[model samples]
Target: MQSTISYLWHTDDLLGQGATASVYKARNKKSGEVVAVKVFNTASYMRPREVQGPGRQKVLVMEYCSSGSLLSVLESPEHAFGLPEDEFLVVLHCVVAGMNHLRENGIVHRDIKPGNIMRLVGEEGQSIYKLTDFGAARELDDDEKFVSVYGTEEYLHPDMYERAVLRKPQQKAFGVTVDLWSIGVTLYHAATGSLPFIPFGGPRRNKEIMYRITTEKPAGAIAGTQKRENGPLEWSYTLPITCQLSVGLQSQLVPILANILEVEQAKCWGFDQFFAETSDILQRVVVHVFSLSQAVLHHVYIHAHNTIAIFLEAVYEQTSVAPRHQEYLFEGHPCVLEPSLSAQHIAHTTASSPLTLFSMASETPKGLTFRDPALDIPKFVPKVDLQGDYNTAKGMLGAGYQSLRLARTLLDGQELMLRGLHWVVEVLQTTCRRTLEVTRMALLFLSSSLGTDRFSHVAGRPEIKELKEASELRSRLRTLAEVLSRCSQNITETQKSLSGLSSELLKNRDQVHEDRSIRQIQCCLDKMYLIYKQFKKSRIRPGLGYNEEQIHKLDKVNFSHLAKRLLQVFQEERVQNYQAALVMHGQRMRMVHETRNHLRLVGCSVAACNTEAQGAQESLSKILDWLSHQLLQDMTKGVQTSPPPTDPYPNPEPTDLVLHMQELCKEMKVLALDLQDNNHVIERLSRVPTAPDV
Candidate 1:
C-alpha cells in the first residue's frame, strides 16, 4: 500500500529524508495540485497556524526553492574550482545578512555548511543565497554555551567533534563561535572548492589526525598529511594555484580565513566584525589591470586608504621598475599626478583611461616646484563639470537629518573640513619651501641667461622671439598677481559673511543646546579663512603687486617684424640656461594656478554645505557670482596670451624676471615658516565638541 497520511493529500512518492523530517510528494485533493509535505518527527516545528499531522506529529508545508543548494553551484563545471570573486562576495554578503538576522533573534545555527544554504533566484533574476534547514539551530547567547554536538562531521568544531563523534567524554561547551568556525570552512569551500583540513586517506578514517593537525598549528596555519600515515605535516599559507582566486583577492581572503578558522574560539572573529570587514572591502577594494610594453600585470588591487606612493611601491615589487622610474601615461597625456593623492582617487579621476609605462626617469630635484595653493581641496572635485565638488556636497546633504542625526551630520562635515585643512597646511608648508627653492634656482639660472654673449655676434634685428617670450612671462605673472589678490578679496567676502553668522551664534551661545556644535562649525570656518591670512604675509615682491614694471617692459619689445636678415646663430649652450629659467617659470606658474584651483574647490565645498540652511542662499549667490566673474576674467586673460613659441631659443630679458623671483623666494620662506608654525587650525578642529546623543 502507498504511504498516505491525511485525507487532505496523497503521499504516493517519497522525496527525501533527513534526521528529523521526511519529505513526500503529495497532491492536494481539493485543488488537484502537487506539493511536497514535510512531516516532522516532533510534535511541532516552530509555530504553524494551520497544523496538519497524523495524531500529535506536525506536518509543515513550505514552498520549495527550486534553484537548489550552494553545493550544487559548487558542483557545476564553471564553479568546479570555486565561485568567481564577484559570485563569492555575493554569496558571502547574503549568508552574512541571513546570519545577522539570526543573531538579532538570539538564535545559533549549528549547521552552516554549503548544503544547508539554498540559492533563490528572485523575479528580478538576482541570485540570493539564504540559510535553510534550521533543524540544528537553537537559541543561544554570546555568553551562553551548549555541550551538545549538533553539526556535520567535517564542519563541526573540534571540541564538539571530540565530545559527539569520538565520544571522548570531554568537558567542553560550544559557544556561538562554533557557527563561525563552520562558516569559515563553508566560505573557504565556496571560494576554493575544497575543505581546509584533510588527512592522508579521508576525513572519516583519520578524524583524530585531522583534529590534531587543525589544533596543533599556530593561528592561520594550513596543515595536512600528504603521503605516509605517520608523515610530517605539510604547511602552507596560500591557496592552491589551481584555485580561481586572484593573488590580490587571496591576500585579503587568506587573512580573514585564518582569523575565523582559528582553533581557539577566542581568536575567532564574531559575525559582527566579519560583516564589517567584508563590507569595508566591498566599499574600498578596486581591481585594476596594469600593462607595460605588451606585458600585462593583472589584478592590481588598490584600496581607498592607500596613497599613490604606496601603490607604486607595490607595483615596483611586482615589476622591476622603481617608483621614481614609473611614469604613467593615460590617454597619451603624460600624467603630472600627485603622489599624495589616494590610489582610489587617482583611479576614479583617471576614469577608464588606460595608463602606460613611464619613459621619463629621474626628476627635477625636489625643491624646484614650489607649493601650489589649496591643500584642503575637497575630495569630491569631479573630473568633468557636471558633477563637481558642489554637486557632490549637494548630493551628500540631500539625505536630510533631524535631531541627533542633524547634529551628527554637521559635526561630521566640520570634522571632514578640519582634516582637509590639516592635510592642506602640511602641503602648503612643503609648497612654500619648494617655491623658495624654485625661486633660487630661477635666480641662479636668470643671471646666466642674461649674461650669455651668444647673441652679441648676430646683427641686431627686431627680435620677435624676445618680444614673444617676454609677453608670455608677463602674462603669467599678471595672472598669478590677479589670482592672489582676487583670492584674498573673495576670502574677505566669505569671511565677512561667516563672521556675521558666527557672531550671531556667539551672542546666543548660552541659550543654545548646540553651543559646542556651533562653536565647532565656527572654528572650521575660521580655519578655512585662515588660508587667506597667507596672502597678507609680507609680499617681498613689493606689494607682490601687479608687477607692472615687467609687463610694461614686455609691451615695449618690438616683435612685429625683423629689420634685417635673421641669423641662425647656433648658441645651444647659451640657450640651455634660458631653458632652465623657462622651466622654473613654468613651475612657478603652476604653483599659483594650483592655489586658485584649491581655493575654488574650498569655496564650492563651503557654499554648498552652508546653503542647506535658510537665509544664506542670497549671500552665497553673491559670493559665488563674484568668484565666477573674477575666475572668468582670469580665464579670458589667459586666452589673450600668445601660444607657446615654436622656436626653443626664444628668450626673455632676465633683469625683471630675476628681481621678481628673488622677492618671491624671500616671501615664500616667510610664508612657509608661518604656515609651519600655525597649529591653531588643527588645535581648533580637535577641540570641536563631540556630537550629542539626543
Candidate 2:
C-alpha cells in the first residue's frame, strides 16, 4: 500500500473536506487498486523550523472505498435513514470484522464516523465497506487516558466531544476506550440515521451537544429504553443498536460494543479484548454482508496498525529529541535514559537513549540549564493574563492539581513528602506557567471571533429579557476573564515565593518547611479549581438565553446580529491592515468626487481657472490610477477586498469627500513610516546574514 498509489486514489476528485483537512481520490502510479488520500491542513506541523511538530511533513493516505461511507449508504433516500433488519446486520458484521482486523494490529480507529467508513465496488456486484481516514487512528501502547480532541462532529464520542468543547487537550494516557466510544457512536448513528447527542437544528446545536458531552448525562437518544424521568424536554433516543442489528451480530458485538460506548468510560473494553471477539465473528458475517475477501480484510488491519505504529513512533522520536530542560515532551511515555545518568534525572528527562553507569551524578547536574531569568521565570510564562484581577487563579489551580497528587505521596511518608515537594515546586510552577499560557491563548482565541452566537440559545425565546441582555452577556465573560486573570496572578506570586523558599528549605532540611509547602500547594489548588469552574460556566453563551416566546418575538433581530458579527469578523483589523492602503486609496477616490460636487454646489468655480482645472484633474487622475493599481496589487498578492456592492456609503458628503482625500494622503505618509519601522523590527528579530566560517 505504501509503495504505490492505487488506481482508486485520484487527486483530482475530492472525497471530503473538513475543518482541518481535505481528502482526495488518487491512484498509486504503480498499484491498480483505488485509494483515498487525505492531506491535513493543520499548521501545527507545517510551521517553519522554529515551530514545526512531528508529522508536519507527512501527507496522510488511505485506500479508496467505492461504496462511499456506511453513513451515506444508510442515510441516503433509498434507505430513508434506517436500514432493513437483515441488511443492517450485514453492515454491522462487516464493520465489526473490519474493526477486529484493526485491533489485531494494535490499531484503534479514533474516528468512527460514517463518512470515514467506505465501501469498495466490485465488477461483479455490490462493494465491501472499508474504513478510511486513518489520520485520527493510533496504535495501542500502555493503558493511558487519551488526549487531543480530533474528529468529525456528528460522530464524536462523549469524551472527545466534551474535551473539544472545553478546548482542552486530554492527557495522552488515553487508550482503546476512545475507539470503543467512536464505535458506539457509529453504531448508534447507523441505527437512528442521525447524530447521537445533537438534534439537527440551529448552529448552536453543536456547542450545546459539546457542553452536554462534558457536563450532562447521556441523552435518551443514546441511552436506549431507560428513559430519564426528566421527560420530554430532554432529547433522547431508544437503543437503536439492539433493535436494528440482527441477533447473531448483535450477540457477537454487544459485549465489547456496550463496553466501548459505556456511559461510564472506566468500564469500556480495551482494544485487545474488542479485537478477539470481533475476529471470531468476521468469518460468519463477511459472507452475509459484502463477501469481503480475507486477504483484503487482513490488508486493512495490517495497514492500519502499521500506519498508527509508524506515526506514533515518529511523534515520540521527534519529541524525545527536543531540548530536555525546556520542553514538556507532551503526553506520551517519558523517554528511557541511559544508565549513566542519576536515577532521578533518568526519571525526569525525556531523553530515550541510555548512557553508561559512570555518568550518574549525586547532586544537581552542572551543565543543566535553568529557566530563562530574563523572562521573570513564572511571571512572564503564565497562560492567563496575570495582570488582571484573577492573576492568582491559575496558580491556585496548579496548586490544586499538585495538592491532589500530593495527597497520595504525603500520606506515604514524611521523606517522600520532602522529596515530592522539592520536585513539586519546579514542576507545578512550570505547569502553572504553561496553563496560564494555554488559558491566555484560549482567551485570545475567544476574543478573535470565536464566540458571539446568541440565536442558538434563544431560537425559541429571542425577546426574553435575559436573551436581549447584551450588557449582561458581555459582563459575564468579562467578569470570568477578570477572575481568571486575578487568580493567575496569585498563583504566580505563590509560585515565586515557593521557588525562593525551596533553596533555603532544601538546604536546611526543615520539616516545618515541608509541611508549610504542602499546605500552600493545597490551598492554591483549591482556589484554581474554583476559578476553572467559573470559567467553564461562562461558556454558556448568548445563544442559549432565549425561551420560545423570545425566540419568536426577536428572531429577526437575533439573526441580524448574527449576520453582523459574521461580517465584522471578516472586517477585522488584520484583514483591514492587509488591504489598508488600497481601502484608503478607494476612500480618496470617493473624496475626489465629493470635492468636485462641493465646488459645484457653491458659487466658487474652482476649475474655471485653467491651472485649477488641471491641478484638480491631475490630482483626481493620479488618485484614480493609485486606486486601480492598489486593487490590482491586492488581487495579485491574494489580499482580500470587499465584495461587490459592499461599499460602506452610496452617497458620501461633498465636504466628507474632500476630507477623505486629505486623510488618504496623510495615511499614505504614515504607512510609509510604519513600513520602515517594521522593516527595522524584522531585521532585529532575524539572524544576522553572515558568511560561513571556514
lDDT of 2 by residue, 124-240 (tens): 774567777666666665454455556665456655665664465665345666667777777766664544454324214446534454235442224332123323324333344
Off by over 4 Å in 2: 1-12, 30-34, 42-57, 123-126, 168-172, 199-206, 213-221, 224-237, 240-258, 271-694
Model 2: lDDT to the true structure: 0.42
Off by more than 4 A, model 1:
1-56, 59-63, 223-225, 293-296, 300-325, 329-337, 340-694
Query: What's each prediction's TM-score?
Result: 0.46, 0.35
Q: For model 1, what is the alpha-carbon lDDT of residue 595?
A: 49
lDDT of 1 by residue, 95-206 (tens): 8888889999999998899978878799999788988767567789888998766778889888877876677887787789899888888988898666777777877888
All candidates: CA RMSD in angstroms?
A: 31.2, 36.1
| Candidate with best TM-score | 1
Distance from true position, residue 688, model 1, in Å?
44
Model 1 residue 191 CA deviation in Å: 1.1
Candidate 1 Cα deviation (angstroms), residue 310: 6.2
